[model samples]
Target chain A: MFEALGLMVFYENMLALNNVSLACGDNQIVGVFGANSAGKSTLMYTLSGIMEDIAKKELMAGGERITLRGSINYKGRDISHDKPSKRAKAGIILCPERRRIFPESSVLENLKIGGYLAKPAQAAETLEYVFKIFPPLTKIVRRLGGFLSGGEQQMLAIGRALMAQPKLLLLDEPLLGLSPAIQYWLAKSIKEIAEERGVAIIVAEQYARPIMPIIDYGYILENGSAVVEGDKDELMNNPDVKSAYFGA
Target chain B: MDILIYGVINSATLALMALGFTLVYGVSRLPNFAHGALYVLAGYICWLLLNRLGLPYILAIALALGLVAVVGGAMYQLILVRIRGMSISEIIASYAIGLAILEGLRWGGLKGGTFTLPAFLEGSVDIAGVSVDFQRILVVVLGALLVGLLYFFVNHTRLGLALKGMAQDERAALTLGIDSDRMAVASMALGSLSAAIAALILLPLGSIVVEAGYHVLIMAVAVCIVGGLGSWTGAILASFVIGFAQILTTAYLGAHFQVVVAILAIILTLILRPSGLFGKQKELEERV
Candidate 1:
């Protein structure tokens, strides 16, 4: 299991996340649900080693104690000191919110860059895999990223990340600003990515409606803290979650 | 007519250097004010090797270009890379380094006495019935070739397209796993290399001086701004416009005010077409 214990992250004067701890196994898809400004992104950032903080950290794969303080532990290895690029090479990739597609580049160039850390030949194969998942991208490989519609760009963004062949995919608000149809399309794609690739996922979203059913485990965040954490079904029906998210 | 041809030739060289400068800025989001120093230093280095070390012309030029690339790469790593988070300050600091380089070259050149290089190609060629220096033809041809190659590189090649992608969205580029640092270094080296080529061509135009790059530096800046900073074609067209202006001003207004006229033209362009003659609003990406 990959986990974080008693993690606290601060960005300057802002307490972005406080005392957060979570765990997920390779077979489980962990969903992070919170309202806007509930520190969902910060939690993901802290766990991904993109956030700096002061905390007593301990991460363990099975029984052995691993020091993951102010860092991320991937597969019993402390990847805290690794740069984001290196961490990415180690199969830990963040798709990030907003679907940050290099808008001036062609769609193919976007995918080519995703496989940049891997062997060039392997990267080409990965590019083909990415294209297979998003076939529309194959036709528009020459089209600039900026010219694509929002839905296309999001698909391209996720497709680009998939090119890395990540073991742990940290997706931050993949559905943000997307139309309902596109959102569902992406949600299905994410499920397919998880099941077909056997990639562990930590998807942070504002609501559980679209994502919770597919997740094996879940955490409910409120004001920079995880208030309710449990199995997806248990957390979905929890009273606090209903009151917070559904406003019931 | 000869002077006008010279202006056209010189402007082509300016456009060449400015194109590189603009590309570096577009991709790296840094002004690269050290570009002027790169131009002047390349000329000085080439002159040193050719005249002092007695090296062949092509060898000297190629060696100078290679040196600038190394120095440029090192400079970016040592200074710009560390301050990637500091955008405005980096631009200002690069200019400061450029000033320092200009001062050093001026001081060194004065102490060492006059510096000069024999024409690499030598003699004059008829361009549109005008008696043009062969080096002028070489400069134009080389400049066009470099621009064409650069266009292909950015438009067609893997690395060039990658760079263009980086220029579009740095964060997105990083997410794609493009090593932004490596791209930055390569862009800086190429920028310096472009300037180095300009220096090689410019050196034979006149005797070397410490402040020789100042005029060209200003021209580079003006051309970039007028060409629509990120547009390659824009830079080329703007270079010709400035080149013709320089020639006309030198003929009618005199040498003293040639630069002043050029500066005025830039100002006029800025006032009239802020996005540049070729600058479209769409090419600009969101960055602070």
Candidate 2:
């Protein structure tokens, strides 16, 4: 289980995430939905500790002054000040937006690279499971990651993250720019991965229709704050959620 | 036959000189201007171990390489680690360190043509109709073997693969628990080892001098620029191109024109293809 309390992030004078708290129980799929600039990515980055890295880099480069005030607790241990690599070693992996696959590396190599923290036996087993869950990756195993289609790249990205053996996987816009069919299929696969692998997932997306069915609990983010937090049926019945997300 | 034999020999020498520079830049994007200093330091250490410490030739070489690797790693941990992510500062700091090392060696009496490493083997062999010294032949053999070994290491080993991943995407690698600073240190050590190996084999053909350090730096930079910075395959190919060019320039024009050919190659590559032959960063930027 993972819990974040009173998360606030600011870039100079602009607030990216304001007083947002999120929690993910074991073997549960939590969805955070919002339109553009709703702080979905900011929330994910802050959760995965990448925001700390960005803040460091920015400060070093004298670019921006980023302030982060939050406490991230993973099963009672506070990982608020942990570096991104340390967080990943603690089994918190982020499958970033745009499927940032190593474009030059082969599909298999990308997956292998993702297994940097796993033991040999664990890596091998997870690699096999990745290919099993995303069978299309098996067909183009030798293809360069950049050459793969968007759908295949997304699958590879998820598979690559799975290779990291994450306890809490963060999927940020996994279906962005994807066709409706592939989006539905990926959503289904995400559900199966949670149920089968028992790995907790927190997915942040703008398109809610496809992801809404699979999530047990969801948060609707507007601006930089959580506007609504409820189970699936409650959200579907809400008039504002209906028009904004489902167009009902 | 003479051109063919000499061209291959020249190509191998360039390859050996540029390998460490490329490796450092490839993994961590560190220019490592001290690469040449490390090369010269390795030779001096080998000389010291052999003469002053009364060690055997093989043992001296091995110890010298190990020392250089430690020094290289320490340099990263102590200094380069602070100024990382700033390219200009990294280059300035590294170049300053390189200057101190080279000049310090000169101040300590590393000059003169007296310091020469013994050839690994003593005999001339004929390739085609051209006769070449055993030392030059050793350079070619060792160069090819190093390249092959490096290829295998980067593609097959876990640390090497993690380094490759870091090279491609630092953030993505970080998300997989590959610490960038640790990889940078590892790469520096490996690069230093490579420079020492190159010195052990190549310094036998000529005396070790401080000037050779600066020369090696310029030659490595030239080869990297033409080959496309941080690209291994491109570096090897560009070495062959510039190697043959330098050899042919020396053959026809004058021996002094050899360095001119290298400088010309750098300028031409920059003007025509700023990204070098195999560099994809610029191309990707264009697409985006």
The residue-by-residue lDDT of candidate 2 on B31-93, one tens digit each, is 999999999999999999999999999999999999999999999999999888999999999
For candidate 1 chain B, the 10 contiguous residues with the lowest summed lDDT are B279-288
B1-288 per-residue lDDT for model 1 (tens digits)? 677778768678778768768888877877888888888888888888988899988998899999988888898899877666466778788888888888987777533437776677889867778888887788888888888888888776667766887787665555555667889999999889888877777678777776666776787788878888777778888888888877777788787877786688689888998889877766555421
Which residue pairs of candidate 1 clash?
Answer: none
How does model 2 fare in lDDT? 0.93
Q: Pick by lDDT: which candidate is best?
A: 2
Candidate 2: segments with Cα more than 4 A from true spot: B286-288
For model 1, residues A51-170, the per-residue Cα lDDT tens digits are: 421121111112223223344567887666665566676777778677778765678877776666666787777787777777778889889877888778878888888877788888
Write down the RMSD of all candidates, one decimal each: 5.8, 1.3
Candidates in order have lDDT scores of 0.76, 0.93
Give the CA lDDT, 0 to 100, for residue B223 in model 2: 94
Each model's total of backbone clashes: 0, 0
